[model samples]
Target: MGKVRGELRSHCPINFGIEIFGDRWTLLVLRDLLLQGKRRFGDFQASEEGISSNILAERLDRLTHYGLVTAERVAGDRRQIRYEPTEAGRALLPVLVEMAYWGARHDPRTAAPKSFALAYEADRAGLLRSVEAGTNPSEG
Candidate 1:
């Protein structure tokens, strides 16, 4: 496991993972980057969850601090910033995928598309690769 940004609660891996990204907003930010191809601050704000600017800023900072994401100046535009997932961030794809799967199976109101669930079951590895490549697997 990668190093967490702050002091750990315990040696338990689950606890550590939760400490890193236990908040509801943190995973949403990761979802935007991993699944929605959202790279800008505004894009995240535009998400359906209606996240506040303060919370978005806090999550992005924490993700960056934990080495899950990187924020860089967009080329030719100093004022514009692009957020990209680091390798460590990309590594969370499987976790996210499994969570989606579980939610689809257990939650009747889950928005996970049937096509995505089927495609994921058919080619889990390929789907992960597509996601890591910044493409939506269900779209293809």
Candidate 2:
């Protein structure tokens, strides 16, 4: 049900990237991974947007196939798996942050966090850095 690149396709990185994440829900899932560190099914389902289980499963599998997310079995729980963002996935945080900021500005009543709005107003780079720090605490 999605577009596939043909052998005759030209090389446009943005187009290629869009093919991977141009869907309505994919980016939202990526946002959850990047912003909230959501790794399990329940965490994703608990999102205010309410994604269905089947769709979440499919999205997680797709993201894993695309190398954006890596799913590994939880230790001592063979039936459970945890999904985490790969480095490629973390690279999309800026885009999500920008989109959130734009949504907040266009709609005064947007329900995004006040901290995000304040950070957007002051310095998005700082916010991104903080997120990166949170994700990689060992770097310090």
Candidate 3:
């Protein structure tokens, strides 16, 4: 069955987000946009997980439709498109940070920095601020 853009399984707050980005690939796409400084289709395709082109297209479309991402054509290159995280998407920083922190702490093979948890624990707000500052906003 085909799903509508922005469609949700329920009105529950938690369910709302889960419905939009419950899939691992979708979340990874968001991670790329929000945390990894990725902007092009090719960049996402080259992700560590090696997502296929088809799924990447679908997830990008879904994120754009859900207002978590914005796709815009760059100047001087009408054929090139760049994806950026929206304010709504940037709002997920804390969530991503927590998830990263958990993984770093629990996953023995985690590539996250050894001091990540400590630095995050010492100044969570500062960490969030830095990430927010670094996030590239959509161009006008």
Best by the lDDT measure: 1
Per-residue C-alpha lDDT of model 3 across residues 1-140, encoded as one tens digit per residue: 12336556789999998888888999899888878899999999999899988888888888888888899998999887899998898888889878988898899998887667777777778777766777322111
Candidate 1: 10-residue stretch with minimal lDDT:
1-10
Candidate 1 lDDT, 22-74, residue by residue in tens: 99999999988987889999999999999998889888988998899999999
**Candidates' lDDT values, in order?**
0.86, 0.78, 0.82
Model 3 residue runs over 4 Å out of place are 1-6, 135-140
Q: What TM-score fits each model?
A: 0.88, 0.83, 0.89
lDDT of 1 at 20: 76
Ranking by lDDT: 1, 3, 2
Best by TM-score: 3
> Residues 1-140, candidate 2, lDDT per residue (tens digit)?
12333343445988767767878788889988888788887898899898998888878877887788999889998778899999988888888878878897789787866666777677767777887666422123
Query: Which of the two, 2 or 3, has more TM-score?
Result: 3
Show the colliding residue pairs in model 3.
none
Order of candidate numbers by TM-score, starting with the best: 3, 1, 2
**Candidate no. 2 TM-score:** 0.83
Q: Which of the predicted structures, 2 or 3, would earn the higher lDDT when compared with the native?
A: 3
